[model samples]
Target chain A: MEARNIKLEEIIRDENLVYTKTSLMTDKPLSFCPGCGHGVAHRVIMEVVDEMGIQADTIGVAPVGCSVLAYEFMNIDMQQASHGRAPAVATGIKRCWPDKYVFTYQGDGDLAAIGTAETIHACNRGENMAIFFVNNGIYGMTGGQMAPTTLPGMRSSTTPYGRDVALMGNPLKITELVAMLPGTCFVARHTVHTPLAVRKFKKAVRMAFENQKLNKGLSFIEIVSNCNSGWKMTPVQANKWMEENMLPYFPPGDIKVNGEMVSKTAKSE
Target chain B: MAKIKGAIVIDIEKCKGCELCLVACPTDVIRMEKKVNGKGYHFAYMEQPDNCTGCANCAVVCPDGVITVYRKKFED
Candidate 1:
């Protein structure tokens, strides 16, 4: 008999080598297309939850639209809210379980458009929770349509001829506008278009959770994300496009941190 | 490679004006200029030319595809 040489370790290994834990919880693999910023934002949220060691004590509220099914990927206790109702859901969660870390994950369509009222009221009231808003400029889940945050002159299904300010209006700067509110304890805008950018985004997400841990009121993050399918760009191009287009439109910085008015030069210790 | 006053340079067209460099720059040598580019975006310029340590933070955060920082040759 010929000596059989099979790479058993690589093929049929069932020891610790095969028991490597995945950072992402196994419920549903990401449905986001290649280069979608939603993936990056979701991953960052998970990383923060892990870093804070609050998986068991954390309650995440899912919004309608693209991230509506976020509960599938995140193994922690999750709640599904009505369209643009994440803030309201989050409010109930935090109040019902004051000791648990509460968070709301929303998309631009959910947070900026339909859910605008809920988001504003929640921030104004200084609800003790964290909000992650992903602004991809269009309503992705409902077939690429114009969103409140869709930039002027950017064509979408609803604004096929390119956005006309007179008719369609201009993009809404939800993050900056909300930062002006007095009740928000922490506010920042960031993106994950690059590796270094990812690091910074993670830092911001971590701070948001930290605030929740300390019960320091609400912390809001506006993530300048990408929707390659809607944008008609490849994953790589989408990232580059966001870097060149979106970041300029919204400069990244902590609008407010711990009630301290932070400027572009300020950094949280 | 020698002491030729090495500095950082930014490609303005690619810069998104995120100001990541300002935060990363240890010497506080960078700040966003009020003058908007043709693209309607702010460009980060040297606040104090001599303070730049060439750490490349601004280049890293630039979202608009702008930025390249480097030093001019010292006139010895």
Candidate 2:
């Protein structure tokens, strides 16, 4: 029992260290709820920036959502965009700084609802920037309201009786719609539920950054994350629910790689 | 032969006690502490660290990003 009392400072040795928090992230604690996916998503993105040696030459656009304060956590040049206007802001940043890596962090509500026009036009014009979309189904920040990406039959604050497809219309599959555009160079959907998923998502982010270096148009990555607080479940339960309900509709895979749509059967695991 | 050993450190105060790492860990190396942290949450700690493989699954899935893992190999 006493062995467990060993202080962290006493046990940490540089030579034996296999993993540590990336310095690219600020020391500030995350504002997300306990067990939310946004924290992991933020870490992976920062880790990729750190690994690519692009921290100094990268600019991020934060949308109006739970992660609106993303700039506070990520130690990089960041711009705060109005609701659903991240793509537009990112476009301006990319145009002004063509050589720098530019990206937008948007929630489903911000990207699919309010900023639909900006998102489509940006993708259609083949803006040389990365778009990181966090799709948590329901709106997390504004009190668990139904969003454009909310699943059918899912119970949200606005749809307490569960979303009726006939009345509410079908949930928007914006990722697939963006993939259909010819301007997108690398379009993929991923979730950060497990270690394997995190690895794949990290690779996708890395590829999106690399695509900017090659001037390969736009790279869009939709990360289907969990909103435990909004979903009315524990962190673990929400992930399980997402796997059973969310992943089926928005399967994690590369929708478009290098300007070509990945076939339905040949989607990467 | 080489014996691989791994250890982890958790910033107990930062931890939200979400237990995501507990589920992600393959070797069952982690367990929740009976004592509560300053936040009154049951934070995670290593209960059976000898089984850890330094796979980093726990750290990768941690929402709070509080866990740090280390590994080393010793000749037997």
Candidate 3:
């Protein structure tokens, strides 16, 4: 039998949708590059916010970076922070409105580099807020400079010779460092290269927000994302490279659950 | 026998044709359209609607968040 040509309107009218854009996202087209993980990461966070019915009470602090305009895309209360100052700004917001959900969305260069002091202090103080760090290894928005999380021997415009570990210090595992601190209650590193990974990331995001409601100190989520434009590769190639290179160095899994460090064996599972 | 039908609606204007959804679809239900959107990039379309299980894999992987998946149940 010949397959029927069904119209999309028919299905919509039938109301059998399995998936649709979250209401938390504005109608504005994402300014991110095509196939960039930032868009996926944004969607995952918005999806969680929408699902949890916390859009009104939730406030997001976007750091100075590619995501600086995040307030334009996310349909909620948002604040723009100076480079690497999102954590501190979030701390103020959460402190002012302890009952509200507060989060900081930051990038590698912003969070792990210049903002390292604020990030460390905020997590160490056990601020009752969520921190979403997008680690793409390089300064993507600022013309592909070396970032604190950039892997050794990784090539960036600033490190054209493929980062020489001898000249530059080793890549800083900021997430792991924060997890070791007593203030961080939940810490996880996730990616969005696959469907399963996106699901896992969403779960982590939701838990991070839930932690805020529980007043459970700090919840930090690091997404090891890809910078296809900065890496000078197509989206597919970037994802493949990230899987082969980034995954090994920054393994994706829960580092700390409920203020307890997860065993290495369970992390690999 | 029970027949299942699935469909994907692409917001043609919103799609950048990154093809992430194409690779994510387990049943190979999506293909890039020859026509480009306003952004001057090819948009995705349902190439084989019959095979779609509406698993939402394509939607999940879409960076642009432009695709919506729908499934219909019917008797054959």
DockQ of all candidates, in order? Answer: 0.02, 0.60, 0.72
| Rank list by TM-score | 3, 2, 1
Residue A58 of model 3, lDDT score: 95
- In Å, what is the interface RMSD of model 2? 2.8
Candidate 2 runs further than 4 Å off: A1-11, A264-268
Q: Is candidate 1 or candidate 2 better by TM-score?
A: 2
- Residue A208 of candidate 1: its Cα lDDT? 89
**lDDT digits (tens) for residues A1-269 of candidate 2:** 33344344443688889898899989898999989999999999999999999999999999999999999999999999999999999999999999999999999999999999999999999999999999999899999999999999999999999999999999998889988898999999999999999999999999999999999999999999999999999999999999999998888899899999885432446
In the order shown, the chain A TM-scores of the predictions are 0.88, 0.95, 0.96
lDDT of 3 by residue, A227-267 (tens): 99999998888999998998888888999999998944325
How well is each residue in B3-59 modelled by candidate 1, as lDDT tens digits? 222245555543445454565566777888898776675767777655544444544
Cα deviation of A260, candidate 3, in Å:
1.1
Which docking category, incorrect, acceptable, medium or high, applies to candidate 1? incorrect
Query: Residue A10 of candidate 3: its Cα lDDT?
Result: 59
iRMS values for every prediction: 18.1, 2.8, 1.5
lDDT of each: 0.73, 0.91, 0.89
Q: Least lDDT summed over 10 consecutive residues: which range in candidate 3 chain A? A: A1-10
True contacts kept of 3: 0.73
How do all the candidates rank in terms of lDDT, highest first?
2, 3, 1
Model 3 per-residue lDDT tens digits across residues B1-76: 6666778889999998788898888999889999998989899998987788778888998888998888877666
- What tens digits encode model 1's per-residue C-alpha lDDT throughout A112-217? 8898999999999989899999988889998899999888888889999988999877888887667778778899888776657767888989998888878788
